[model samples]
Target: MSAENEVRQFIVAADDDGIRLDRWFKRHLEDVSFNIVSRWARTGQLRVDGARATPGDRLVQGQTIRVPPAEPVKPDTVKVKPDRPPLSDDQIAFMREMVIHQDASAIVLNKPPGLATQGGTKTHEHIDGLLDALQFDLEGRPKLVHRLDKDTSGALLIARTSRAAAFFSKSFSGRTAKKIYWALVMGVPEIEDGIIDLPLAKQPGTGGEKMHVDEKEGAPSRTRYRVIEAAGNKTAWVELQPFTGRTHQLRVHMAAIGHPIVGDGKYGLQEAFLTGGISRKMHLHARRIRIDHPDGGKLDATAELPSHFAESMKTLGFDLSLGDWIPLDDGPVPPTREQKKAMGRAHAKSVRKERRGERGRRRG
Candidate 1:
């Protein structure tokens, strides 16, 4: 078939299910750009099972995607290079030692605190750059499925293949993947176990990176926390289970409740520091993760606390003998597409109502 006339059809595999249409195109058709994809989607040139599709549409298994023909790639076109640099021998050895669990589909790493998951400006070394080392005679390098804060340590999931990556990514977005974190907070919560149902929005003027409680115009966020042990009301060992995966959700939520995680200078400020002999590292750790495997069965892994975290726990007389918490079934399920749309409409209506009420109060 001529390159200009070569229309293609693809069947969505189970691995690709729940991914956005634009992402699917980028993965399978690397030469395609977001602009081209968006243009096609807007002009009805892209169809899923004979129906026009949008870039934001989530694909499901066994659906047929009809891709319109496109111009042939020119041999002289500039190619995008891999963002990561080659790994050194020492870096390779370091990554290998961090592996806590490995299988054909995924690898779980006990990522240490201060090691960024992906490289950024001024970040010369990171797990993403060295993932090639974890290939270990495999067909392809592992891919990171999700991210933990640079200061947070523990179970970071790496998918061993494109198939595994898609599956795990969907699992996380669907909220089937459960994560439990352990944190040592500066103060204890008044309630031993309760939910923090606060809305969170990015604080402006901070490069939109820092989060703060903003109920009127914030995303709905919820977290379930339990105080496991307390050290004379000065510090407490807490387990945090976040139902929503908003950036800095756990840190901001804990701080909003007046029990900031120890050593969280950004959120906790002066209260983050402890005068006792405790290490000044962020006390939060990604203690455990449980998710359904792409190839059947379950994927469960737990990471041991980093040295500083363990030492602080011991010093505070918190029991390290308490094993990891089992995946909680009571956590909120992620809203489906219809549910999310309904929620968005409701939120818009509420915002309009609040604006009217504020105008009335101002006039009064």
Candidate 2:
């Protein structure tokens, strides 16, 4: 083996206790796999103190372990040709800065708008799909923790191991994680603080791929909004706290209030669409996120306003450069749990019904 491929072994210590053997190795081995670990146990590729060990076995307070090098697999590196589409050095720096936080547990990123969180047939270098392409220690590949919309740029989280991934996966699916968004709306509301209780369903298009919002039979969505800036009848800066994390909850709710974001082609004003609306960019920005950190303390991360959003603010006459909002007033408190459950449930029902009607019309 070359010096690079030479295996490094270590003794399991007190710090490694409580975590599974597979997980411990995920932080140590290059290209670690749960399936491979399982096979190793059956075939004796792995040994604890020079003996076979099970996948679920946890290391004791002080345990001797033998981590033999993983059997050879496929080519380890992504062979990007020297002539692959040349990227500016600045662009590469931007990519690295996206990964905001990382530990043995997870990796966080500041995802830019207009980029898919993952890759598809039309997708190129999206976040999740490109995790392996990212620079990493000689340990394991990165994984995605959650998804942000294509046009919604902000704090995106990823996992480096399955154990770390499970925590976030459950947090998002169970509505424990909170995501905050900022949007420039067309007008201010009468109520300074209120909840947008709406249900959101995916409206399928002719191609049966792309997604739109429908009210028929959709998922429950709840958004709590507070006005941060009021720019007369032309526009307003608002912070949206999504309670349920439904698809396009903030956008749909703002549209429902007759204040679609400036550049939202989907739920935006038709005039804006005709006249290069919202400056040809979506106004929604994922601004902040709060989650319980696995190690300790709360994970409160924020993504600054991108240039497009700043330009939109200036174009809308919000005055000054980015983040120069003069607070006209502070809105109300966050939605209560009772409010979220009730409103979210109702919204989901309504969306589902609207989607069903839309489907019927398409069929007819």
Candidate 3:
């Protein structure tokens, strides 16, 4: 084979360490489409230290990656993404207004209701399209690490760099990131402070847009809720925390327990709506997010409520000062593998010592 067609190998560098295998290709091998990478991985042509590797696998510094020869691209057959239109001056201002917190590695936006996190069929105006306005002087556009439903407004995080994106993505997927939400439900839950441990799956015939509880064939889902205050037996103000990242998890769990979130007609049907000057918009709000930062320490951000949600809180006689007082966790960090191994050894030694002492007493 010619030199150009020969297989190639690349070593991970310090800067590229901890990034996903696919992200490495995007940074170094720009011509390699993700589909091509997936094909190579599936066919065992891609390897990390002689072991086949997938695109989502994390890369360590000094690891060697085996790559197959580049395939020729036909310009006529290649499909290209259409360029997005430039943001208008008003659009730029609107995005800027949503910025609640910004740092070197992340940007937190207070996404308002009626704005989609990402664009889909017939979805033109969305937070993803407006991301360019938040780029600032960065070398690359901000990347979304997680998403909130279009109508479920609250704090949304944007990663500033590829490294931050990988780190934040792992943090979210591993359930290490904690998010707090404030919502108004139709009625108070019978169990004031409870955990909704229900499996969820997409409702059939909904085109994967809606979710429901499924006992046999569904992914495990859990949500913790605490009622902050209740307005008689009619309405309730509650705090929600999701332990698993399932589609519409909080919404489905709340509705399954018979206290559908107020204004969530999709799940609650007719009972979700509230009268007496209450807005028909979804009352769910992402209040805060706490995750370990890529650059050490933690990135904790809080978003203020939109006008409608704030007004609803006032109407329900809920005090704003008491909303954020609850701490999500006061537990210790989980032990690492090495720490667990050492603990195991210590435990065995203790057991051995206790048995030996009993034997000595019996012999005496």
Candidate 2 residue 348 Cα shift, in angstroms, is 25
Looking at model 1, residue 85 earns an lDDT score of 67
lDDT of 1: 0.88
The TM-score-based order of candidates, best leading, equals 3, 1, 2
Per-model TM-score versus the true fold: 0.82, 0.62, 0.84
Candidate 3 per-residue lDDT, tens place, 169-236, comes to 98998889999999999988888988788889999999999999988888878788999999999999
Candidate 2 structure quality by residue, lDDT tens digits, 74-192: 68542434534555666667667787776666667888889998777878877765565444662666668778888888888876655556567767776778777788877678787
Report the Cα lDDT for candidate 2: 0.70
lDDT of 1 by residue, 124-226 (tens): 7788888999998686778999999899999999999877898898888877888899999987888998878888899988888699999788888888898
Report the alpha-carbon TM-score of model 2 versus the true structure: 0.62
Mark the regions of model 1 whose C-alpha exceeds 4 Å error after superposition: 1-21, 38-69, 72-79, 82-84, 323-364
Select the stronger candidate by lDDT from 1 and 3.
3
Q: What is the lDDT of residue 297 in candidate 3?
A: 97
